[model samples]
Target: MLDAAEQYSREAFPSAKEFLRRLYDFEIYHRKTAPWNPVCVTGLPGGGKTSIFVAATRLLEDDTVNAGAGHVLPLLGFRHLTIEDERSELGILRRTCWAFNRQWSGTTSSAHEKTRLKEDDGFPMRDLKRARDTTALVGFRSGCCGVMVDEMQYMTQSTTANTLVTKSLLELSYLRFPFFFAANFNLVAKLLARPPQDRDRLLSNPVVVLPDTVATEISETAWKNYIRECKRVAGGVLDFDVDKDAESLVRYTFGLRRKFVIIIKSAYGRAREAGRFAAGMSDIEEAYKSTAYYTHRKDVESLIAMETSGKKEQKEFVCPIEVDSTEAMARHRMAQEEQGRAVAEQMVIDSLSPAGRLAYQQAGGPKPDAGEKSKGSGRVKTPVSSSSLLAGSDQFHRKRK
Candidate 1:
């Protein structure tokens, strides 16, 4: 599955192939150098940034983990390094200790000690703290060479001048270990690209940008190929006729590869429910409606409106699916009403005691007796349920019967 996903990504994303090549190059560089300048990979959210790093790591680690048969690049560890890992200096220390152990467990005495201290409840807490605090990461530098930090945007630090994460980054930078920082946007800038002399000098190294925007012609073709491959592999699990409304498929998705696949998956499920051997354009359209919450409906509607408005343009345009203004208004109203009803229901539930709520039924929820009035309102309260309101017809039917 990983191999297929990696291949699919390489084709679907224009930058993916180049990114993988660079990642491998970084591993090679890290192997030659003990610690090196950190590399930053930035892109839009859900833009295949995480996928690239993960896929690259799999390729590098497979040789080492399996039979040690593949290229031995000493140690390149894969971890979901987040800003949360180093909220405090000690936190960073603990994370670094564990990260090193993950890469080189058997070789280093420091790794064994750290592992033992982590698992040992009986061990002196003070001693453990001292050991982690005083011992430098440089000691274990030879064992583990590279580290991948994902979601660098979430990294937080104390308001103090010398932040723990900053200090940790500095420490890692000095070691010359290549740090791969992957984030949705310029989050690494916060960690590495600071002002003046404070700015991380190591960050001046290299940057890998992942493809995140709307699908280009190449991207659209790649996505279509991906769909065909998926259908072939699934063996009738999904019957998506990519050729039927390929334009519709790409347009509705707004060119985000991740969103495209999600829509396809949802549409395929709808097809399965209808007992159809293959999903038609209708199924795809209906599936789109069901998962419409993910999209910026207003933006999509505007884009469709603009294209169909018969305005002056150099190119002829066609929309994948028609936006029904009337239906959209009705859906919007319905959604609003649903939300309002939910809020009102929650308010009523909040007003009721646990026992009172438990006693309340779908049939005209429990009403206060004449003797008992609302504490503040001094009025007899009647809590009605929608089910009870609809039950009036049933009563009439029973009487007529």
Candidate 2:
């Protein structure tokens, strides 16, 4: 799979799972140098996530778990799980354990093999708790390496922060080391403003938040990042939110957080520039225009795609996947919207054009959001519009056609 991952760096393949297989192998071999917390990937339902992983090269990972007792086995050298993209938290974990047991248990070699299969007895029990435990091991390994998660919101708390999952990962991350998250725009935002401790951990990651912006106040660096992360699978469809004016995605984000996401994305640019993703300057700036989020919250969306998608590097992954190691990121923008950026004049969004404005509203921007409290600092005012400031700067100026 490692060789395939390297090969993927050259050719475009057919499925996301194949990409995942190779990418997983590459990371497993280099687990010692992996970064961040778990990766998270998100999107609307039926985003074709499962197919991506299934298509990835197999046997890249040899670590196995016991199907007999539903026990998670330690890795031979390192580990990579294609199960991060599974639907639910329990599902991701269970699938991982099952994959392991089927792979090893002496049937072929190790205890983590899934191809080994089991007797019809179902002795492993394979209940939700066991599933969670097995998956938890995947996360536990992330502390020092990378862990992938797809549809991040589904496996977490209702709040944007996904407090429970964050808390659990944080506790274990000290030992697990690295993690990743790949989820949709909104959920990624929520996860970003995680509790102080978790947020701190994620900040250390080489995040790649996507370009599904709700508004525009973003800088040019962010725009380039987005371009680097776009992924196109079998169909002509493009994955990872690559519309021209992303205001539509904004409606799903909180205003304050939306604005901040722009900055956070910039950080991703800086990180990449400084070898955050271990990529060269040309490579980081050479790919997709979107910047997929990583850090404590990277995702398997990219991983699945990396392993399962076409082998050709159609474009730089908008987010990390295996071999790539990226995700969409989650946040809690809406949970704490402010009272609509109280200002004295008509407030304009920072980055939208006339047509872009229309697109924004059309993409779910009708409802106005309440303003949000500034992080940590209390009573911070919303940004003053440039037009408003310009107006005050030269009130005496005359305006004529």
Candidate 3:
């Protein structure tokens, strides 16, 4: 049996840090209320993606049976899934609706048939409207329903899924359950770049993205799309050691990585307002850790890099390519990161010189001396930690044991 919210503690989502605090409040409130709001946390791979549902299941199960003061029967029931699973997005919907109604939360036949059914039912989550079924999803969801579509890229582009499920999600606001769609880059890119017709479904929805905006990067609003705004948020944090050029770094490192980059890259003010920085290895790592692509970024990056770099290449490749001998493509990325890092460091340090640090404290920002410890606060972290990154890459560094 799944445990309750209280039963599941912070360790369940190690990478999420204070973020779990946000989930716990949202989950608890949704359990005892109406109009369930499902949150979609999108990010790059290795971003700690599945932790939400782990917490959700525990929250839901607790609401079902816990005797604690905070527990209550959830107005919503849920089913979680990743895209790699066989069922298409729509198929998963059908199964979820079936489970919600049965109150069993276990697998059932694919047909979604239950003896308790009358022949003319329909499913609103799937928007199933066949005249042959009696237990349609419309009635069940009229009160409570929700589905967290994890690893959403597996969501097929087929008409049944893309069109129907998309429509179903749009119409879901009428019901209590609001869908939360989270995934790595490939999946997010498909959704963001969905054709004009398909993209309309998500035009005005709320989003929270971390900084890495490649095809698989989640766009959940870690960095607003305005550089001026980012500058406002950046404040003194901008002065830090940069590995690449800030402008090019923002443009290329995670191409299309953050959905609102053009806007946020406009300024370097993050250090003052939000205390979150987004232009270097540290900022990028923090943004990534906070997005939905936790388990998906590395895969997508490798795939794209391999696809693009592998084509028309006759030369041998090496891991941990030395900075000086690296190819132009690789050099471009490093340069961008370095520039951004340098610029950010400059800004930060400039803010901290004997006189500037005092002004920073007056501005409501962390004092310059406090900068060293913020790494643990999710302000930003180094992505290419030369010392630790190659931990699992030993297989490729073979010398024939």
10 residues in a row with least lDDT, candidate 3: 314-323
Per-candidate local distance difference test: 0.48, 0.37, 0.41
Off by over 4 Å in 3: 1-40, 60-78, 82-90, 102-127, 130-145, 157-176, 193-198, 209-401
Give each model's clash number.
5, 139, 89
Q: Tell me which of candidates 2 and 3 scores higher on TM-score.
A: 3
lDDT, residue 184, candidate 2: 48
Model 1 lDDT per residue over 1-401, tens place? 23433432343223534433434454443344443456656544555666666665555441232213242333333433444433544545455555554543322224455456468443223454454423223222223335566654555433552344456556555444445666443344454445554454545544444222112445446667766776787677665466665655545554345665676677777887877766656666666666452453333444344434434232112222233455435434443454477569868866877567656633444344335445455666667889877797799999999
TM-score for candidate 2, please give it: 0.30
Pitting candidate 2 against candidate 3, the one with the higher lDDT is 3
Q: Which candidate number would show the highest lDDT if scored against the true structure? A: 1
| RMSD of candidates 1 onward, in order | 17.1, 20.4, 20.5
lDDT of 2 by residue, 11-106 (tens): 422344443443346344334433334434443222333323323324344454332234343432123344322334443444444433342222
Candidate ranking under lDDT, highest first, comes to 1, 3, 2
Which pairs of residues have clashing backbones in candidate 1? 35-176, 35-177, 36-176, 36-177, 83-155
lDDT tens digits by residue: candidate 3, 42-136: 54443335555545644554134222345332233455544344333345445445545555442233344534332425444343433102122
For residue 242, what is the lDDT in candidate 1? 67
